[model samples]
Target: MQSRPMPQVAGVEHRYVVANGIRFHVAEAGAGEPLLLLHGFPQHWYAWRHLVPLLAAQHRLIMPDLRGFGWSDAPHRGYGTNARVDDLLALMDACGLDRVTLVAHEWAAWAGFMACLREPGRFRHHLALNIVHPWPDHRATIRHAWRMWYTALWEYPLVGGAVLRHWPGFTRYILRRGVTGVWQTPALEEFVESVRSRARAHAGQALHWQYVLRDIPRLATRRFRHQRLQVPTTLLFGEDDFAFAAQSLDVGGSHGVDVRVVPGGHYLPEERPDLVAATVSELFGTMESHREEIVG
Candidate 1:
């Protein structure tokens, strides 16, 4: 494989590991508790560039280009949500990470939700950004239907790939329009180019198609009745996130879910890394306080 210059972030190291049969390119740094950061569509681990430097000072950060994104292998198959979760689990096994604090955004949040539910003990806490839990409210989804209009275009196979390949501006347009704070930059262009790979483009489309075809149908049937998240969870959303409505994503009053509406938009990690880092630090501080209380 030809080596390409990784996006620079001070003190971060890059490596690759075979997890669940797929080789993953991971950017890691720091020490102490393991913190796994998962990036969303049209982005690789580089999406966390701003947030990583701050978090790396305190935690052993493990940021991977989720399966098909970034420098990771874009396989012809294994784009399913469960498969992604399995990949994380395998990565943990390969790295000897028995437990971790999970931080994820967008599509990766869905997989994190499942991983936390599946093995609650393995995750100390979950700090989810700009995405909702699995328990979808039909009425809320209906009311916020306009928010997810982009999914329609990506749910098809060839159509999605064609637009991604031919229309270079389409992905960039989505990122620019999605965020309230950030303007066009080199990072946005890099992300747009990452998905231009036919394999990654197909993987992105498959993700959307699976949600519509497999995930939604299962949700309708209450397939997740057996799953419950026991890990402490904090869901932070941007007030202006174009994809998800802040009001509609209230999973509060449920066990272990804490939702906070912050000032910003969809790309919270990039748009407001300070807020993201502070929120995470507070969560960890609270956890430490609780531990001390238990010890005392």
Candidate 2:
């Protein structure tokens, strides 16, 4: 059976804002309670393209191409988790938003979680999709450990950039592996074309590699123990996700986290936006009803 074409959400308005000395490209839609969606590595705001509209009916959706991806400035320094958290907050400030519902996938999931740690009250709730909790010390449990080889290589200064510059084909190869079951021909082509436009094919890959190597597990453990999130939160995962099944379950269980499983691979939102949207809508609706009951 052919998959349904991605839904036609209302067109998003694009804008650029200066955040922490870097310019960030933001795609915005709807106009209500703020909902910020953060994309992961090897992808840009386009990752959320299918999801924005479903939630937009009830939220003011804000999706940004985080620091080094898409139209955002790709500064060499400050790619760390703490730095990215700061960048996200700075963007919120630039947009005049004091509070929001934060949602993220992959590396941005770690970034979003850290941002909540820094200022819990600033986020009303969090929705993390397809990521292991951010703990720096914990070893990765991804099935194909070799797939992360690029992460270690990218940590080197001169060598990493040179490798990317010399061999652009590697980037596409790596991304293709990461994408796996999530993309059809048109979707895959769209992503490749977007990355190619950013710089040489390898520049985007280098930026993503930096994100993958960040010490996320340690940071998350500290935040989880020391600073519990009082905000209502949800964790969405794909049953077939090869990257951190045990870890994802543990984190969710430990925190009494609400968990939902959607049909897809690692790229939950992209592969099954309809399911993702329905799940998100249900979660937010439940939160709203509970709030109204308390207020009444």
Candidate 3:
């Protein structure tokens, strides 16, 4: 069954793989050291469409629609972070990849953290875009929690489904305003129209509800404090993002983890694909560092 309309990128291959007991839809392009690209909320593998061409020459890209998000099977289960992490690991096994560089955005970034901490050797490096790492300062998070008010609409069961299925403008508005810069013409249109589809919208609501139910409590209780990140990782956030305050994204004192704030809002993949691509290359150790970027 078609999950949703997917955009085509030249050199991209569409295939399905069973990972963690779910049939996942994946978009593949390029060929080199494996690199995994995981999309965040309200988007699928297509979120990285802009970056694919830029990074294709350097690394083989694996962009998967999280369990229910894109063309992947939307089972009524496995929306929790642990399940998501298992999916990542299982996907790697199915693809004959023991380790790969990771570029995870938004919601998926949160799970990326868990995957690294759970199996440090499973990933060589992680470039987390627009999401807080597990080791955040709780005081700052409490003070800045208001930034996530928009989630309340999507964190509940019935309400989130209705919003995505009925008032798709809410998702469209988020996508429109969340960008750090303007989305390239047709790309924004593709994302905007996608939320109107019930199958795709179902995953958005379910994932958000799972976040509030499981991930939020984990963050609140310092669920990852002792796990110390062993994999080299970078948490990159936008200066104007609404979901997380820069202060709230503070990471534990570890040389392996660094924070970079770039110019933009929440949607860095769409707005700053160049920067994302550069970061991916840097993490992969496949490109000499040449791009100039300001660390805010």
Per-model TM-score on C-alpha atoms: 0.95, 0.81, 0.91
Task: Estimate the overall C-alpha local distance difference test score of candidate 3.
Answer: 0.81
Cα error, candidate 3, residue 204 (Å): 1.7
Pick out the ten consecutive residues of candidate 1 with the lowest summed lDDT: 1-10
The number of the candidate with the highest TM-score is 1
| Tens-place lDDT digits, model 3, residues 1-296 | 45445788888999989878888888999998888999987778899888888999978999988887767887767778888898889998988888888899988998998899889998888889999888788999999999888877776777777787787678777777797556676776666666556655666777788888888898888877667788878888999998889997665556367899888789888888888887776665532232222321
Model 1 TM-score is 0.95
Clashing pairs in 3: 180-264, 180-265
Residues 1-296, model 1: lDDT tens digits: 11455678788899989888888899888998888899988799889888877888799999988877889888877888888889989998888899998999988988888889888888999999998677656678768878788777776889877777677777888989778876548888888888877888888888888778877787668687556678988888898888988766665536467888999988888889999999889989999999999999
CA-lDDT, candidates in order: 0.83, 0.68, 0.81
> Measured by C-alpha RMSD in angstroms, how accurate is candidate 2?
5.5
For model 3 the local lDDT of residue 71 reads 77
State residue 211's C-alpha deviation in candidate 2, in Å. Answer: 5.8
Candidate ranking under lDDT, highest first, comes to 1, 3, 2
Return the clash pairs for model 2, or none. 134-216, 134-217, 135-216, 135-217, 135-218, 136-217, 136-218
Give the alpha carbon lDDT tens digit for every residue of 218-260 in model 2: 4444545545556666778777665546343555445535667
